[model samples]
Target: MREEGKSIDEAINIAGETRFLPVVLTSITAICGLIPIAMNPNPQIAPLAIVLIGGLISSTILSRIVTPVMYKLIPPQMDEKI
Candidate 1:
């Protein structure tokens, strides 16, 4: 975003705003996809469903909160872009 002349806050805000809906919808789809597999007592794939659900929850929280906080803490590298 700095390469596009946006300030740090502007960059973070734009990134967060742009990502929110897609991330939310993707998370919803992942959870929905896992539900049926998770509910069924499959000896083979049931564990995958549990792991995927946990991963989805973890990633959603990180993307929504931790990522923005990290963005605030980490400045763009000087050599990376303008």
Candidate 2:
């Protein structure tokens, strides 16, 4: 689609929508994985949870930053009659 000169919206719509699910899922998984560490009575999983949580937050922010840039970089489709 990028090679075909399709616009960001067009390519995105074609590919599904929003394209944020994977990012959202990853963030959720990270937070979930940290639960055991965060709530651990033994304190062994605390570091793991912290790292996962941090990564999830970073990824979410990065996604927000990158999505718009990607959309801008990709040109929209020109043939509306098709």
Candidate 3:
């Protein structure tokens, strides 16, 4: 929401604070699934593990780009008091 003068910390804090519980739960679920695949000996699970690993890495990278751009475009609420 840079357009409206919201800082990066404000946007991230707003997003994280609003969705904290659900995000944590989802992350936990993903980690649970990922752990099994990551530890599995089966060759078939190897690809799945690789895909998840790649996606996790890619998403981490892209978030740096996406968050700032999104903050610039969305124009966060001014009176929300984040």
lDDT against the true structure, per candidate, is 0.88, 0.71, 0.68
Clashes of 3: 1
Residue-level lDDT of model 1, residues 40-64, one tens digit each, is 8978988989899999989998988
Off by over 4 Å in 3: 1-12, 57-65, 73-82
Ranking by TM-score: 1, 2, 3
Highest lDDT model number: 1
Which consecutive 10 residues in model 2 have the weakest lDDT in total? 73-82
TM-score top scorer: 1
Ranking by lDDT: 1, 2, 3
lDDT of 3 by residue, 1-82 (tens): 4456767778677765566566556655776678778888998887788688668656655665676578667755556556
What is the per-residue lDDT of model 2 for residues 34-75, given as tens digits with 9 covering 90 to 100?
Answer: 787777776667776777788788878877767666767864
Q: TM-score: which is higher, 2 or 3?
A: 2
